[model samples]
Target: MTFQSSSKPQAFAPLSAESMAGGVYGWLTPYLIALAKQNAHIHSRLLHLTRTELHFIALCLALMGEKRDDADHFGAFARDYDRLPRRSLLANYIDTAGPGYSPKLATLVSKLAGRPWRMRSYLRLGELYAEPHARKTLCHLASISRWHLIALSRLPAPYRTYGVLRKIRKRYDLACVMFGIEVVRRVRTDMTDRQIIASLERSDTSRIRDWVEAHYERLPFPTAPTGALTDGTGAVSRPVATARDLFRAAREFDNCVDRYLWEALTGRSCFYRCDNGQRRIAVAELKRLPGVGWAVDEIRGPNNAELSGPERAQVFAMFREAGVLPAPQALSRFSWFDLE
Candidate 1:
């Protein structure tokens, strides 16, 4: 669509409701005035603009702002703006800004305008434009829904890295990405890139409980050879030798023991189910500290509730007789919720 110049002068006329119907044109007046000062022809061109042409002009202003350095080039573009087609205008406007200009913004704006205009997405584009990796990130923004764009833009600054963007681009599953964000943000921040990707890939359900259960399937079974830590008087403690066993223990005891699968697989810690004559009593974690040979890190009853006085005394006495020392203040009670 081409905008034609009219003989009747409506220059400096008040903006009507029809001219600013979608609210997208509200921010363009200030920018247009700023640009008209640099080029006198822009002031005359605004006199005969239709609403459609006004939308196009708003898009152009959004793409190439009224920067002081590019006044000459911007004036040249403004002089010929009425004759250019919609596609040509977008292409030429981005081209005039050189290689650093991200085409993603234009793509997103065009898509937003195709239907009803989304003011939130337009505002979010402005916020994202200031980021260092905005060029790379905007490439993916063109394909996502407006709601997804808003959700992604609201993520924590640390989670807005290129790697995370690549993950979002590849999967295009905002729910899975959100689940991964929660795990890394609240559960474990030290998770590696590969680990985070794996977690995201394994997510099949959006529910937190189901997601945590599915995560257990990715952990490898304990491979290092270790014996059971047992005591006399029918109170025996046996090492959880497999991932399945740990999962089962977590389900039966209603605790988060499965989160320690990484530590167990790496041989840094070992979990044992303490039982008395085939009846489970408590769960224990034995951590191997650098200088301390073997220390009883934690011993908790079902649901992570504390054991009774006698039960605690019995467990401690068993560890003492078995040459296992009590964990020091610095090393005791390691929780997966603690940041690495």
Candidate 2:
């Protein structure tokens, strides 16, 4: 089933309620009816939908099952259909008619819509859907979180095969649930996926977390541009340059700064330690926005607590002095962390 269109097709007439109620397009009726309750002019919008958009909605409705009642899902699909994965992949997955409304489907759709770079791997998964044990393989894939998917995307291509994914599902559940996502992420290096799985299976599980943490803490921090700042009143901020520093900071501040190593490593954002002379205070995260340049994304105290008003004011002043103050609307804008 070819999903690509070589030529511009004639405009399709607006679909009527009756035609959609029972026929080839009948699967879409439930979605249209549910969305119509929220949008009175849904039928009019349907007139503007391309064939691929219609099919995409149907596939989403089918996979989402009862969750299809949410109009925002449909709205997102309609607005970003062109940016979605190849129509062929969608059609092929729909043909499989696998499980419905699994966490995997949600993660898959979210990644497909929000992270276009991951589309190639998903497309590869779509190609594998026709093989034997596809349903089980898909179930395994769906069971893991988006973090695992991100980690999987970074692996060598050969390791992304169905066999490795099965191993990942099992190890991801055991290791991640036990050691947490940060440790799993920290341990993910070149040729480490299979080795980690093997070690977990063969070695004593009790020492794995310590080993992982030690392995992470011993690695030298990668060199990157820093955004360090100081207020000259014993107040200062320094960038977190290594996984070791992040791990130690997480332990000392009683926060999850370690979870953000991927962000820091990828240079999408930077984490900094805020201090007042010898007394540690807070952790500040900064990101470079399109128009805003470098802006403070968040500043949190110990235990991920929000800074007090006075303390926050001081931090903001320091950032302002450094010329990297966050815009009033910056927090409201989309962030890469939203994927988590």
Candidate 3:
């Protein structure tokens, strides 16, 4: 199913009726504006990258997840090789800006790349960054220019946006959710701690998968992996279990029940109001979990505010139905909910 079609068709509602005047949007607007400025600043600096560099930057932004534009945050994790010593394990592999072929990129292409006829964009780019041996087999020569020119050079004659760079930027944004969901599914079924560690030892794709799973599983309502998710380039595909269809229905029912209780208990939809110190701690913790660290910045995002309880409830309901989260616990311990 399409991402939108999976959720309830109801209008996207605010978490709280009372927050209608100004709540989530109010909190997010200024932050969004700041992000726009930062994107411009960063884009201006990125104009000179070759095609190879453009693709790597896209992957980095996708993996970074959230706040990819926060100069301080991005610099803290990206510039200093040892800045977040604890995160050095996940952060190091995607550090193309530091030097040559990114190990993480190498492993990804190694595992996912197909033979020439059917290769997908993601895997093709992965190959570009990782497979030096294959380069001699391909025909194109390298091209580089100002960022705008390079961006324009890649697009069709008639395009809507400023250039292909904008399209590339959007791809990174789309990848945040796609990869996030994929990571959750993989962590739930495909990987084990030992295997994950082994992949890390070799500096491979497993590092990214392992990191995603570790932090995702820590979420309050964790989904167990169903072992049915398939890896592909353009879109995710999963098979439905006909025999367990009833069980899926029951689980969704339970999700609604849990969502209600959560709202009743917390009186807020999203827990976005955590102070800077708390957010810093949370982001830091996530960065250490998987892949390149920047992706978390996008997932958590710069818009920090408690989602109105209703909106929070809606999100939970949607994700639960989508099976991203486990069935809500009837009596989840809320003492920790005080973290908000």
Candidate 4:
């Protein structure tokens, strides 16, 4: 499970538990903050977790799941996390989202938090609510497919925020439904590469819509996500005006859907117990290059911690080579946010 370059094994900086947690938080915090600010009421109401704690929980869950049963180094982190107040906080949210908010969910969360989570269901549930699109996507999932797909298709691309990307993913979900595939089946588990590729094919949209409308009932309310981007009417903005921006958007969009196309296409979905799904998604974004094969292997290997600086630099270099990431000098010219 060690990473090897073509000629030899590459040396990597060792990862400590705290540093790993910090790495994940840094990557996710800004996105969560932006999302919280965009939907002020939703951020203030309904959810009680802060963006930092939410992000930390997700990273911890992903890490725990990825390293489960390995009696090695990661076991220590898992043991340490079990004792944290944060563990119960995550459990509380899950209980709230369960079959009912009270005793049912309360009972469920209590039972679940009493031990380490085994399956990704609870984790997935938490993640679904963490993104900006959680509400809209859940509504689409529970509603008529025909109207939802049509509306989503009408939305513009080069998606600038989580809201826009959610729309695109809804259309994708509809397309899968049109092919006689159920929304839950396409996600929430290990899927084969064949199933993944087949998703690209066209299907009978009208027939699928009819079936969905008849079979599924609309949900009671929008399932608000744990995080989101700004409401888009802000002076501070992140625009996808360049190839780098688009590539990054695509990565984030794939992330929003979680364990669908990116997982399957990259072969990460096939190894549910052993896989840390995000690595493959990141590697898949790397441009075709001389050293990329090795890079991908390194990313997919054990250790399963955050990418080291050299590894990140290598990935970025590939993007630069592919013309998706601009040079450092080029990035300084843009004003991403206003002072006001």
Candidate 5:
């Protein structure tokens, strides 16, 4: 249940939680601040949780998590999340995304915040709403293929943010998703070398649009999650993740996402429950490497509002058969907004 470097493990450098912590240390503040300014209002209105908020919340949750390594060792510093409270003031607007979109979005956001795609779509939803000269990031997403959306939608959780991001960005020549330049960090969990290779293959971007079209309806919604259902539970409250927070996480992701990672070997999903397990890369050092991957423009996956369920299903089938999904682990579930 550790990374052993796939083909050329040594070809690429190593990374770990401890090392990565230091890697992003000095950068977190400025990135978070800038993203906050960019997404201030939109993160307030979206139907999903913002990725930044999700990342911090996930960080908090991870800190309070069961595993020591995953715990928020940053302590009080971590608890002092200004972004969380700033967004709380914005929760009043999440119910304002029109009528139908608002209610369903409310359900979707809560569900996303609770579990499953708490990071991916929520972040996507925020990003879609934030574009300086853009519209329908969802449109782009929808065009991608429902299967890709569905797969990305159904990621498992303790609501891990980075774990999920790496899953999508590392697969299928992900160089095209970013606009110009980006930093990509692919974290491997308990995945064996074979599993890592398979994950990379399953999420090839070449067929991403096709995958999204197929599984449009299969997205995780507020209807079902293996854990707690989002029936107004305090544990899954409508916590507003501020635009600043969401923006920050996205930027950091942008920074790491753009970095070109040849092939990284790590655990399944890069989420390790065992702190005392094997030591792979020096996460801090790895974070510092000249990590710049690809950054494509446009949005394509879900939110297309164009395809039908049957069309989506067919694409889903094709992706499973063809093996180019964002999240192969999500096949068991159909709803993206399912509970935590």
Candidate 6:
């Protein structure tokens, strides 16, 4: 194809609606504006990342796409991490952002090292951010920047607008949050699962408040051993405030154990990195949650340290005979539908 400065503007093939279940021009158009501002090297670097790396980048794009810049919801999503959409909607968007269809994912990520994003570009970014792959990997180096918008938005101050209000200087709109489904999560660091779960199981649970406050992770006893509180990272138990809190603890414990095992055995978590840091775990990990009493990992692997060689075979056989592990009656006592 040949072009001249005077040539009439062109329209690429219209974004396919099926391919666009993730949102089309709403995502790509803004990215083009972002791409225009980048220097070549950075752009090329992002363009050259691996397929997995490319998916991570697109996750960022989908995330940053929903930012609210208009006077109404300006800066509202700041610090808002848990607002992921339903699993089905996000899967659709991933299909949209995934490489087989949207070739621009690489291009957009390559520019991350160079460009600054505008708020409007985020409308679709919100939907993409809700995508599960994006949610699962939100802790990746590529994914982390999108979350850092809380700190970055601090720059374009006055940070004021219509509909939304700034809180402690963060863009916080009451209206958007009224219907916002974002699930605000707690960020826990360090401390391994055996460490966390052991802590929880050992602690006193007489007081409901105190019971929830126990630490479940047990920090790998340092091979050389650090006297660091014997709690590994010095994070002792703290009070759990909601059902989500217990659930989060259970989830993290499961993830830490599974991830540690996977790395020791397979060198990776299901599809992402074992240490991908948000360190999100599968729900099955909740089975042996000490007090929780469910056994989800009925899938069984060759080497489970918690279980010896013979024990592994036995437990898995039992798991197969039992089929899927069931959540405890106590777990049912709490409504997952409502955290309160």
Each model's lDDT: 0.59, 0.53, 0.30, 0.32, 0.27, 0.30
| Model 2 stretches astray by more than 4 angstroms | 1-227, 327-340
Cand. 4 Cα-lDDT: 0.32
Better of 2 and 5 by TM-score: 2
Candidate RMSDs in order? 10.0, 19.9, 29.2, 30.7, 32.3, 22.9
| Candidate number achieving the greatest TM-score relative to the actual structure | 1
Clashing pairs in 4: 35-228, 35-229, 129-225, 129-226, 130-226
lDDT of 3 by residue, 1-340 (tens): 0122221112222223344224223422223233223344333443343434334434444344343444555443333322333234235534344324344452232222122111124333433444342332121223322232333333322221222123234434334423543554454466664454333334333234334433332333212122222222222222222213212322432322222223212232222111122222010000111232111111111222233454334333433343443222211223221211
Ranking by TM-score: 1, 2, 3, 4, 6, 5
Model 5 poorest ten-residue lDDT run: 267-276
Comparison by TM-score, 1 against 4, better one? 1
Q: List candidate 5 stretches off by more than 4 Å.
A: 1-56, 59-77, 81-108, 111-114, 118-122, 131-340
| TM-scores for all predictions | 0.47, 0.37, 0.18, 0.18, 0.16, 0.17
For model 5, how does the per-residue alpha-carbon lDDT over 1-340 read when each residue is reduced to its tens digit?
1122222111112224454333222223222322222343322432344544544443322222222122223222223334455344234223233222211222223223232232234434443334321222223332332233343334322112232234455444243332111111122233354453343345544443332222222222221101211222111111112223222323433323212111111110111000012311111101111133111111112221222444334333432332223232132233242211
Per-residue lDDT over 1-340 for candidate 2, one digit per residue giving the tens place of the 0 to 100 score:
1122223222233345565565334546544444433343444464465543453354454543333334454444433344555443344333244423222333334223321222234434443333334434445553433344454554443334445444344544444434433465565665366665444444344444444554555454545334677777788888788778898899989988887766776678777888887777898777776665577777778887767767777778877886776545323344434312
- Each candidate: how many clashes? 0, 1, 25, 5, 77, 25
True-structure lDDT of candidate 3: 0.30
Task: Indicate the worst ten consecutive residues by lDDT in candidate 3.
Answer: 280-289
lDDT of 4 by residue, 1-340 (tens): 1211232212222344544433233433333333333334323531456434453544343434434323342333333443546545344333343332121211223222222222344444334334334424434342322333243333222111233323235445544443433442344135453342233233234444433232222211112111111222221112122223333433544432222233323333211111123433232221112332211212221223344555445444443343443233212323232211
**Per the 3 Å backbone cut-off, how many clashing residue pairs does candidate 3 have?**
25
Q: Following a full C-alpha superposition, what root-mean-square deviation does model 1 have from the true structure? A: 10.0
Q: Point out where model 1 deviates above 4 Å.
A: 1-31, 34-76, 100-107, 110-226, 230-236, 241-245, 255-270, 275-281, 286-321, 325-340
